[model samples]
Target chain A: MKVTKKTKVIRSPKRGFYDKETIYKILDNHFICQIAFVYEGYPVIIPTIYGRDNNNLYIHGATVSRMLLELEKGVPLSINITQTDGIVLARSAFHHSLNYQSVTIFGEATLVTSENERYKALKIISDQIIPFRWEEVRLPSKKELKATKILKIPIVEASAKIRKEPPSDEKEDYNLSIWAGEIPITSTIQNPISDPKLKEGIPIPESVKKLMKKE
Target chain B: MKVTKKTKVIRSPKRGFYDKETIYKILDNHFICQIAFVYEGYPVIIPTIYGRDNNNLYIHGATVSRMLLELEKGVPLSINITQTDGIVLARSAFHHSLNYQSVTIFGEATLVTSENERYKALKIISDQIIPFRWEEVRLPSKKELKATKILKIPIVEASAKIRKEPPSDEKEDYNLSIWAGEIPITSTIQNPISDPKLKEGIPIPESVKKLMKKE
Candidate 1:
């Protein structure tokens, strides 16, 4: 819950919180993270899936991946994950906003070298994509593990900005004849589609079945 | 859709594209863009709504906003927008992935100077948030315009990566008795909530009603 100068939200003080529990919930709900870093003086952002364990964030890329190489250099970076919940329609356009849950973290990512750590991080990332899928599938082999580069980023400075309430129009605009409210948004997971190349006689795993319903 | 050295996707060449239409479609479908830029020594990213006009990308912030000020400085940056469609459940953990649509662009953002251009950019942004909402509400006053800063970034280099098909497991892994497939995901706009303070005789606007059904 500690706030750092970098993680503080200046514009909307009421909506920002540096609480660890709040930040973690947002991160855990979304698998993808937009990692921003300086690459050759240009700011580059890559959307990659991630997994979380306690305070450590894990991401994997090919050993030769440019993103992984840059992350290993330990340049200070920020990772952001956001989920849009609704469109807040206001009487005035200026007051219009989004009902979203977002978390931004500033940290340093290092290449995970230890085999045990790398193995665990890999499983965590897999499970993050589809909960319990890690144990359902075959683990990585030595060659696969070697070819993959996993990085661990410690959550140092982070903040969550969430706006879930109804629209707050200007006092005078309340008299205007405009419909003002929130059109709620939600992500729905449809039924699972079996892969064409799936082996015959294989039953749909419970893990994949669980994904069909809301988490 | 011009492909520069940095905008190209190298790891999965088959999944990447540099066509203007493809990139624009992805951008148009998503409203939030994760903008990345370097500040001092740290790389920072912020989630902001954006509007596209031909080849120009416009984003607004408070005149004193750190993101806007830094962007106006003309630092090289990348904007990434992504939509996750499904969870690709593979037979092996290493091959697990997400069926996603994403676009990344590299450009230098410069502050809008002319008042006319600023006004138009603001409308484009408003409409981008909710189509046709710009005309429904009052336009910004002179003071409001001056207090806000808008930056335009030319999409000189961009690429889109989209995967919408079923999972592709390893040839040998097809023999495993684990389910291999995709759980399609979709973001749905729920029923609109009328503001508690809405004035009498005010009806729900057509724009808010249109948002109820899919576009």
Candidate 2:
């Protein structure tokens, strides 16, 4: 929620910024996060799917998740998310970089305990992967709820860094006449090949069908 | 270089001990990392390129990198790298998951100072994009070096979480008629399109040319 720090890199300074709108933009686009926390004396990092609801971020895994168990104990945690836009091929090695937007939220995450919030958190996390599928599928039973743990971390201490544009080079290098620019890259889903054993004549849902039209 | 206290995560009672070698394999294949750290009073995260050398991980950005600067100060830092292999579609929402291999490293980073080590770090970071290009291109000049800051954080505290194969469903759900399985995914680069203004007859380098042949 606060923008206390930002960076200025010469080759890609324009790409770095500290703003809520920019941070939210990047967070909304990515569905996964790498959660880092110290376990014992060493740093432990884990990747998990995450859902952002208002100011709080929710992440969950099996009740037996080692990282989650340690994290649930109120260990300090850092969660990071990123989206790659393209590859920048500068005229020089030093000038080369990737066009990306990333947000990092740092804080100690508490294990969610309220039963109502826990179920809601699970619903939000599931809906993130496939909207409305939660309603279509049978809800979790009491045992299932007890077997899963969801951790909620507030976005109170978060910042965003972004980079976009053609490469930056010294004037002298630019004059040397080497080609330089960005090769835009994107995460594109190919045609959805249905499961071999999919139900006969079951039309692809809108969510699965959505990926097919994207270039 | 030791996988000491600062780099260890709780050994999960279940789904643990896939081995460090297997974890490293996943880390090596990933091209991006989301790093989380505290900046001032807030937590900020960013995504950037990273390379591993022995036990240390090297990352670089502008000399004024905020996260890097905060990280260089030995503050707690969390990093996560993930490779998405496929999408798991199941008969029920609770059983749905992803086929992925991800590693999260948590710990404070130490800035690289030795000229020799920095040189090697730069090479590793660059080679991740194209292996031989480090030799093909010019190295950073003294001024460039002065303008850049590189940090080496040992991958001591780390853990890899992975899920493979079809969905896991309750015994009862298996009997209920519904579809279940994985939808594989991968990142592919299309044929390289040369810059429109590329000078006549500058044969594409072997590295660039070779990428074209990959599907």
Candidate 3:
């Protein structure tokens, strides 16, 4: 929403906005985020799983992870989440692009310290992938809870950019006979493959099965 | 790949790496990159389409773009491309992860100078999505070509880290009988939908059709 000296900071420049609904929709659709920050004066981008509860995003990492550890110390960071839906082929190569919905959140992460809040944040993170999985699985132990670091980033300044329609070409180039359109792309999750060492008689939970039917 | 204390930084201690093959594979599978840079002391992250040729990556923007114009002036920047393949669920919620490939290329970008190299880079950028379409479509005209700026960043001091398999949980936790495995995910291109303004007889070229059959 705020334009600085950087413009590429705005993806889908022709169609970009900071609407709350648009930002939430993009965030809910994607679960993975690439968090970028400066490490030792050089840039480092880390891919990690994140869950949003209310306006706060909870990202978890190992207790000793340099990224999470540094984040706990309160450094400014930029997190990006993108979901590609298709390939857009325009008549001109310059106009070619991707049909995608992405959200970029820039904020400083505050470490979650309260025991109760951290526990609920972890549950939210787990339920993000499958809502019912939280109850189906055993809760985390106190020691395990103490070992994990979950950081919360408030979604204050965020934006979404998307391209959904077909290609746009000059009228003169329309008759050139070049193919132009969109190749619909989708991210599909296959049936959950149980681990080889899984215990017998553990029926396939509905939480896990629901993902297979997602389009 | 050299892991400079400044440029090639590792964030995820548990998963980060500076491997050459991993970096190339991550870069090869993706074309769009989210370039992050500090503009006027504030963070800005923008997503844009990009192409890689040899050691340099070519990214273009409008001639009047403030961000791209600043980039052409050798502004410090961080470019990242990530392709998420699947979600990894573990017996323990803390251990949940994602199966993904990403590349973070950091350095000052130099504006491409030679006209021939710019044209060729444009073609490489075009061929990235569809190989045959570059030659099939009309090339950029002199005026259009001159109006765009292409910045190239050498592929140096880059690293890629991946988590591909099922989660590695404690031996005792595995015996707790929770469903744990990878939910395989894939980005597949479906049938192409032609633009409404296209000529009636324009057949879908093989280059466009090839995406649907890609594995």
Q: Which candidate is the best by lDDT?
A: 1
Candidate 3 is scored at a TM of 0.92
* Residue range with the least summed lDDT across 10 consecutive positions in model 2 chain A: A4-13
Q: Which stretches of candidate 1 lie over 4 Å from their true place?
A: none
Highest DockQ: give the candidate number: 1
User: How much does candidate 2 score in TM-score?
Assistant: 0.80
Off by over 4 Å in 2: A5-20, A38-42, A63-76, A107-116, A190-203, B1-21, B35-46, B54-56, B62-79, B105-114, B153-159, B190-206
Model 3: CA > 4 A from native: A1-14, B6-19
Query: For candidate 3, what's the TM-score of chain A, rounded to 2 decimals?
Result: 0.92
Docking class of 2: acceptable
Model 2 has a DockQ score of 0.32
Q: At residue A189, what lDDT does model 2 achieve?
A: 55
Each prediction's DockQ against the real complex: 0.82, 0.32, 0.57
Candidate 2 lDDT by residue in tens digits, B24-123:
7877776678776654443445677888776678998778866677788898777777887777777677777887776767667899999988888899
Pairs that clash in candidate 1? none
Which one wins by DockQ: 2 or 3? 3
lDDT of 3 by residue, B1-215 (tens): 78766444445545667776677767767777888776555555667778878777888877777668778878677777777767777777666777777677778788898998898888887776667778667678787887888888887766665667777777788888688777778777677888888878889887776655665
